[model samples]
Target: MGHDEPPQHQVVANDLRRRITNGEWEVGAKLPSRARLATEYRVGANVLQKAQERLIIEGLLEGRAGSGTYVAAPRERRRMVRARHREQRGGSPFRGDMAEIGRSGTWEAHSEARTPAPDGIALRLGIDTGELCVRTEYEFLADNQPAQLSVSWEPMSITGETPIVLPEMGPLAGLGVVERMRSIGMEVTTCVEVPRPSRASQAQANLLGIGLGDPVLVIERTYYTGEGRAVETADITVPDARWEVAYEFGIDA
Candidate 1:
């Protein structure tokens, strides 16, 4: 093989993908057995398996417990828009986003109060490591299907004595960051997000119902007050196969 040539498994995966795109396999069509495919491709069973697994992670195929792998029906990739207006609007922005696409959005959240901040989280929130913070984990759903996951942290020094201490269990429960902060006389004026691509961990895959190592988009989002104080920071995960993120910007006139 040439030094610049793709890996054998990757070449096989590409061919399989091309064939699928060309309608060689219909949705829900079971693939030939690994042994047969390996023989046809002139590769080992391991290599063929790897190739199929690659497509599985891309949402082109699914493996059943007892049955063999089959082509998956194409999933509708919803658009998730990130913009300042989303925060400015009251209520759950996630729900609004889903409503725009005719899907109902709901979330399950668990909050732990007085949790010690790890070094990374502490730095993000501009708090000292080991300091107390309220942590909330969220699993967002659209049409009762898992859509996004987020782990959020807020410094105790900022919200410990407030009614909105627990994000989802207070007078301001279910409100967006902007309104919640406003309730405490803090005006949130800035939102910053850094998005990066990642692979799903086992836990993430189980929750999102995707293959392990599937592609995902991780957004590090921080909400800040006019004084430049970060009140909340969250790591939001969106499965790449199920969602596409779009950012909207408004130019000052």
Candidate 2:
């Protein structure tokens, strides 16, 4: 194949996508067997399977064990806004984003206190490896469907011995990072975020109800005090198939 030519599986996937878009297969319509599709496309079964898998990841198809692949019903991709204004409003930013789109938002969180920070977490929090910190893992849901995942780390040096040590246990439970920190006399002023594309792990796939290796968006976020101290850091994951991330900023007058 030429250097610029698309891969064989991708070419097959493209044609299949076109056929699906043209309604060659209605929603929930079962596709032909892989052996037949392979023969029809004049490609090996592996290549055809790869193409079908790609479409499956794109939400155009779905596989059923012991059954067959079928056209998946179209899903509405919702917008997830990443804006500084959301944080300023306090409470759960995820909840507010869901409410804006008329979806009931809820989340399950588990916080562990005195958990030793790993190397990466320590680096993000500007603390030493194995340093004590409060670790919280969250599964955010929109209308009770898992929509996002996050693992957050907060250095114990700042919150240790304080009422806010356990993120979801104290009086500030469910109050966002900014408000929680403010209640303890910490003035959080700066928020930094770095977004990168990644694939879903088995655990992530189970939680997000997506196939393993499906595309996802991971955002590295850290909150800083005015004095430039890193108070909390987190990794937020959003499944690409069901959500589109949008960044918004206000222009200075």
Candidate 3:
């Protein structure tokens, strides 16, 4: 083909994609080698290789180290219901977050003591920029698969000397944000979230089993009490490929 013409690799890609979508090759079945396909398609080996790479990036194919490429198994898409946390309904923040979606979920968390609040965290928690705080990191799973991740911070001045000082330890272990605060005489009355799309970092990509730079959803949430004090703030992350966030609103007439 002339340089001015459309790339021969793309034509080969289209044909292969058609074969896959048409069920000519089932998932988990190895694909033909580049040289064989190149000869059969009357294209250069390099062109065939490029065509296969395209499918891999598109998530239609997978490449095993030292093993051949094969059709990728489909990934299941789950829903994350984003709504106002109603304490009256009762449960931990994560439990409530996943309630409307009807998915069975569990979480693993690590708590650190007396950590200095980062600049942005302090601003969100309404404390001085270098204030001491209790920090907790969580990895939430649904049906035994990684569903979401969150890192939460609470001002030490507020939680210090209280049983709920460490979010995932002491008396109120595993309690959601509101209940944990309420146990210490602080009533959480409001929750505000700012959500945006972000790219997956190397660590996040590894944990979420996705390629680096893949899109993920980021939500920044802050909880408040009846007296207007910021009690807790958290950064929540959800992988885009496996989850979708849905927002529901009720209009009052």
| Top candidate, metric lDDT | 2
How do the residues 52-147 of candidate 1 rate in per-residue lDDT, one tens digit apiece? 988886789889888999999998887898877887668988888888789999999999999999999999889899999999999999999899
Model 3 lDDT tens row, 1-253: 7878778888888899999999999999999887899999998989998888777765788888888889998777877777663455666756766666776678999888789998999989889988998899889988666788889998989889888888777777887888888888899898888999999998887676665798999999899998889999999999998999887665779
Question: What is the lDDT of every predicted structure here?
Answer: 0.91, 0.92, 0.84
Error of 3 at 48 (Å): 17
Alpha-carbon shift of residue 184 in model 2 (angstroms): 0.4
Q: Model 1: how large is the Cα RMSD against the reference?
A: 4.8
**What's model 1's TM-score?**
0.75
Question: How many backbone clashes does every candidate have?
Answer: 0, 0, 1
Q: What ranges in model 3 sit over 4 Å off?
A: 1-25, 28-73, 85-87
RMSD of each: 4.8, 5.3, 5.5
lDDT of 1: 0.91
Q: lDDT of model 1 at residue 91?
A: 92
Model 3: residue 67 alpha-carbon error in angstroms: 14
The pairs that clash in candidate 2 are none
